[model samples]
Target: MANEAATRLEDVRANIEKACKPSRREPDDVTLIAVSKTHPAEKISPLLEAGHRVFGENRVQEAQQKWPALREAYPGVELHLIGQLQSNKAEDAVALFDCIHALDRVSLVKALGKAMDKAGKRVPCFIQVNIGQEEQKGGCAVSDLPSLIELARSADIPIAGLMCIPPFDIEPAPFFAYLAKLASDNGLEQLSMGMSGDYETAVMLGSTHVRVGTALFGERRKQEQ
Candidate 1:
């Protein structure tokens, strides 16, 4: 398992490097966040052993359960919250996560701002845009983006950049391009876009951070309700 983790990490790094070539972006300019959601700590240990210091988690509670010990052992592990964040989890998320990728709505922005103030920690945040305007997604509507960004800034949340999940079963380049434009218009630099499937394309399109899961950890086991 440890050997497999190291090999997969190497492959993903190589892919990122290859993807960066055409775009003229160096691999160091992009961060590969290994999404470790739903995987047990034991499963994650191998990747840490492989020297992957950045990881993403879907839930605060699950991260809280496993990460303290892991961080104790593997110092400098950067934890990012890459899932839909409930308003109520703001404080815990602020305290736990090094960065946030799902700052979608007004309520969440407000909550996270307050939480950061309370914790004296300025956690960087990516404003999520519902790029496809899909009904089932967690991001804010594209039209509502400017106001949310302004609000987060007013509330003192550190705006890292923009984030989005283009609709599944679609060519994601246009969506990624639009997100890059949005970030530019908003005067932000960092972009947290892409996942396991199309991250190579995402890197080519200017994603500063690619959240990868299945490629790094293998397919996740279905979670129970």
Candidate 2:
């Protein structure tokens, strides 16, 4: 398992390098977040042994179950919450995640603000935008982004950047590009875009962070919740 994980990590790094060439961006500029949402800790351990440090989890509960021991065993592992976060889980999310990529609403901003204040830990957050305007996505509508950013800033939520998942089965470059533009317009520096499938394109288009799961860990063993 370690060997396979190492091989896949090398492949992904090489692809990132290739993607960086055209943009004159160093591969180091892009942080690879292995999305280990549904996978158990045993499966994740091998990658940690292989020296992968950053990981993404889609649920607060599942991550709570698996990460504490792993983090104890291997210090300095960065965890990101890449799923839609409920306002009720704000304190737990603030306590557990080092970064959050799904800050989408004003209510959530207020919740996270209070949570951060109580915990005395300010987690960097990326505002998720409904770039595709897809009804099923969990992101702030494009029209509401400015107001949302202002609210988050006022609440002292430490806005890091913008995040998005383009509608599946379509070319993702345009969506990635649009997201970059939005971040630029808003004076945000970090972009948490791309996934296992289109991370290379995302890198070429100024993605500072890419969340990869299947490509690094192979197929998920169970359905993502």
Q: Model 1: residues >4 Å from true position, as ranges?
A: 223-225
Q: Judged by lDDT against the true structure, how good is candidate 2?
A: 0.95
Worst window of 10 by summed lDDT in candidate 2: 216-225
The CA root-mean-square deviation of candidate 2, after full C-alpha superposition on the true structure, stands at 1.0
Regions of candidate 2 where Cα sits further than 4 Å from its true position: 222-225
- In order of appearance, the predictions have TM-scores of 0.98, 0.98
Q: Report lDDT (Cα) of residue 196, candidate 2.
A: 94
**Per-residue CA lDDT of candidate 1, range 92-119, in tens?**
9998999999999999988998999999
- Residue pairs in clash, model 1: none
**Candidate 2 local lDDT, 1-225, one digit each (tens):** 889999999999999999999989999999999999889888899899999999999999999999999999999999999999999999999999999999999889999999999999899999999999999999999889999999999888899999999999999999999999999998999999999999999999999999999999898655643
User: How high is the CA lDDT of each candidate model?
Assistant: 0.94, 0.95
